[model samples]
Target: MNVALIPFDTAAPSDGSGVRRALRRLPLRDVLQLAVVAKVEGTATLNDVSRELASERIGAELQRAGSPALRRRSLQILSVGCEGITTPGGWLIASLKAPAGRGFGLALGHARSAPVAMHDRATRKHIGSAATAVRAAMRRAGLDRKAVELVLIKSPIRLAGGGPHVGSTAASRGAAALGAALALGDIYESDLRDGSLCTDWRLHGFRAMAFSGTETDCCEALVMGNRRGGDPLLRVERAVLSDILDAAPLAALAAGAKAIFFKAGIGRSGAVRGARTTVLTSELPPDKQLRAAASGVVGAILGTTRAFISGGAEHQAPPGACLAAVIRAAD
Candidate 1:
């Protein structure tokens, strides 16, 4: 796999000029990914920079693109903005491409997060949209749902809620997972009732790693699978743990992965392994704590501080447990 990282200057203007400038940094044809991470410094807005690049498209080489550019087909962009004090207000767009091979296939798809009325009740619409996105991605890649071996589902959640938004974090993750499962036949529609989501631990989806947060408004999903014809240069391995402390599976599945993605549930009682914790007890927010703890544990093994570690573990794994998956150099 070939991945390139380009960091833009903070002084860059967010208007069309900014994107044009970024393009000047790299060749468009060789670039397959454009992930914009802008850290807000002072009063400057990274969101402004992200919004500036939103309308760009690639017409040809040297052509400035915002996103959804045509490269064999239209490309999807993941724009992430982090506001802070010292960080630069720019981006680190990566150039990612699969290893060269005739059999290699890939797919990308997304759907908005809307709460739909199902069974006379309001529920996260991610289920329906995720189903559509997953199906579309598989179809584009000429693969079946069964061929899908890994998935990453991200949804925006309300951090603080008074009534309806309570448990919004779990709600967002549950909906996304259920939607992905629908496409894979991991869970049946009969099991998706008004109370079935975020409740029934028995109704879990295999290979669907879900994360929910205040960063998004809709559900976004990325799916990767293997086809018999494709001798892929990338490999994905999965594991379902009985609990958070279960490291047996982690060692086996994450052997050679370049990256790892997993979900961990803050114990319902706000405790882990019988120790009282502050996920819901102290003044510290639970979400932040979840992120810290997740990265801490995964970092110890991967020997890198960076990985897709998040909370909202819900049905992603056993209750009070976790789900782990790795991406590695193909065997």
Candidate 2:
């Protein structure tokens, strides 16, 4: 797989300037997934349209590039939040022709859901839609349940009229993760219901890193793993953190890694490793708090602050824990 990081450089994500430049660096037709991570500016009131505007700009730029991959609508995740040391930018991950080599290589594929309705935000309909899309993405990636290393999901967090409903972002994220779990056979469909999301910690996706934002009403799924005949230069590893402070696993995995992404959770309880934490009670958004704290830990280990760390890890990690994935050169 090929990865390119492009900076926004003070430009609003809606401008499409960054994406246009990124297209030139990548083999447009081979591109499979795009993620937009921007910094939060001003009050995050209903007027914030960064996610929606960025999505449209990205789609237009991809279309203009004449990428055939758009035939299936390449997965696009537009997330707006760069808490702590995280930088505002975008990542274009694509599959280019592999040079002659003989090791397992990174493979990526994606699928998008139909627009979810307001009432279906956290309901069974939303869950089933996400599950179906995830399964389709896995099929496209030529990966089985066990072979898939990570699943990145973008779920809707806003109402049609704008703004968020009570706990909408967390609920949507939980539902998306549960859907991934169901698709990967980690959880059963019978265990799912409207109330199952954000309420049942046991039903979680081991390989999912879900992000909820105002990007789009539809759910987008990106599946990544190692497959034969892919680019042999790259490989990805995934691990679960006991908590944000669980640095030993990351220390082991960060060696030679080119990219790192993290999903942090507060878990059902407000405690971390037997210690009571106050993130849940902090006046700041809990998701922001988690992102900032996790970024600090990951940056300290990785020796860089450019890691993609997102919060609202409902049903994606163990209680008060985090999920991590590192893409690195093959041994």
Candidate 3:
């Protein structure tokens, strides 16, 4: 297996030049999945035009490369937003795999779900759609439930006249996480319903990291893990942060990591380990605050600000906690 991370700088809002440059380095086939984590100038309060254009450019470039994994099977994601210390760049990730291997290697599979209607944004329908897609990706990756390490989801938030649904983003993320959990056997289908989203803090996918955006109308899932006959050069490890201030586990995981992905949440209590937090009350959006503050903590541990950090974790982790994963060279 071969995994590639191509980073590029974007100079303007909704710029595709950087993404084009990055895609030029990728080939047309054998790619299990592709994902992008970009820094946006606009916060979630407004519709980010750049993010939409950048996502379109990525799809166009992939089509030009003759890759058949566009809207059908490839898990393509465009996560836009960079607050505080987050850098104004993005990483283009691609994973290629083969059939022969003696030891464990990174295995990847991707699939796109049906387009979700606005009314189904946080409903059981959304969860079912995501679960189906996740299972499909897992099959393609040749990994069973236990072999899967991470399920990175890019889900759509409810849109009203091209605008975001006030508080629907978290609900969408929660639905995505529950879907992943159902597919991975972490939770049963019976555990989920329309009312479970955002309110069922106890239900979550420990390995799931969901991000909601307006750039997509459907759900895309990237299933990653170590397969017995997969690539041996790289391995992935995941840990849960008790809270935003929980940095010790991250420090231990970054020893030789080549890439890191973090999903931050303000927790259900809107506090940090029982301390009152003004994140929910401040004028700034809560997502921005969590992303910025978590970026600082993770950056300090990894000694680099280039890590892929996103907010609005939902059911990806425990409320008020964070989820982190690292890809490092295998010993």
Candidate 4:
């Protein structure tokens, strides 16, 4: 089956009315499934926008204006900032900032030192702060140390010209590593001070990606679990990409003539610009065996392929390894 990626303006309405308008303008059938809807903003946080919609009762207005069938249909909301959004409808929405917002290590710099020193210093501070917060959060939540499946972090990037870049940084990366370790009870303050925080890739157990355009000044984190309690409708899966060449094989495996959605990214050590190919199949495969195989293969290929390789495995994945799939069980 063929899937198309259609871009829409999400900044106009908080309750998806903007998306609805865009959809109406499309030549496609009115009943077509919308895989994902994304919102772009120059200075807005996703959570803030969502909250604003609810707070301002914009959702009610949208509901009132929406077609009766649309109003009655079930809706699921997912959000991602600079990284982009993937929907169950086999669509991927990639959001990019203006040209001025692109650059490496844009958000991190030493108060008074060389770039390397500034990066190092920023890393230390971010890790320290995040680790503290994770520890406190875990203790308050009364969660078993191992039950925390992963500690994901979203931090701001330093852009060029005192602006913001659209990616991660040494500081944000360091914070992600430290926060994960701390959540798993794997690292101590002394360990962090001694430069053991993210110096070893073997201990990399969590996922962290920093996007620069977020409106929030403070960092944000989410603690995910593997248990079946809480929100049963939400399912999450995380997989590692062991090789870049594995992308094709993985895509084939993931597509399996089934409707599936995904997202992909390279690590800091990755090449100047990683090459990635994504496929969204329109039919659901028969079993998890094929689905898992497809997802794994694609990830492995993407991680190891020369076109998408990164050299920063010291604190991320292995030298050639990367992350690929996030499969959410159908509701």
Which candidate tops TM-score? Answer: 3
Alpha-carbon error at 146 in model 1, in Å? 2.2
Give lDDT tens digits, candidate 1, residues 1-331. 2433344444422333444566666555665544343322221122234432332322232232533353333232222222211222333334345565565433323333343323211153557766665666556444587778776666554444343545455666777788788878887788787677766678777778765534355555556665644435555567776656667787776556665566666657887788887787887556546655766666665665445555567666656777887666666
C-alpha RMSD of each candidate structure in angstroms: 6.6, 3.3, 2.8, 15.3
What's the true lDDT of residue 261 in model 2?
A: 83
User: Where does candidate 2 stray beyond 4 Å?
Assistant: 1-11, 29-47, 67-73, 97-102, 158-167
TM-score of each: 0.68, 0.87, 0.90, 0.44
Q: Model 3, range 229-249, lDDT digits (tens) per residue?
A: 766888878898888788888
| Model 4 C-alpha lDDT per residue in residues 95-166, reported as the tens digit of each score | 112233212110100011112222333356555555554454444323356655444343433332231212
Off by over 4 Å in 4: 1-121, 135-142, 157-170, 186-190, 194-203, 207-214, 247-314, 325-327
lDDT (Cα) of model 4:
0.35
Report the error of model 3 at residue 20, Å: 3.2
Report the poorest 10 consecutive residues by lDDT, candidate 2: 37-46
Screening candidate 1 with a backbone cut-off below 3 angstroms (N, C-alpha, C), the clashing residue pairs are 56-65, 56-66, 57-66, 113-218, 157-213
**Candidate 1 stretches greater than 4 Å from native:** 1-27, 30-124, 156-163, 213-217, 274-276
Rank the models by TM-score, top first. 3, 2, 1, 4
State each model's CA lDDT, in order.
Answer: 0.54, 0.73, 0.77, 0.35
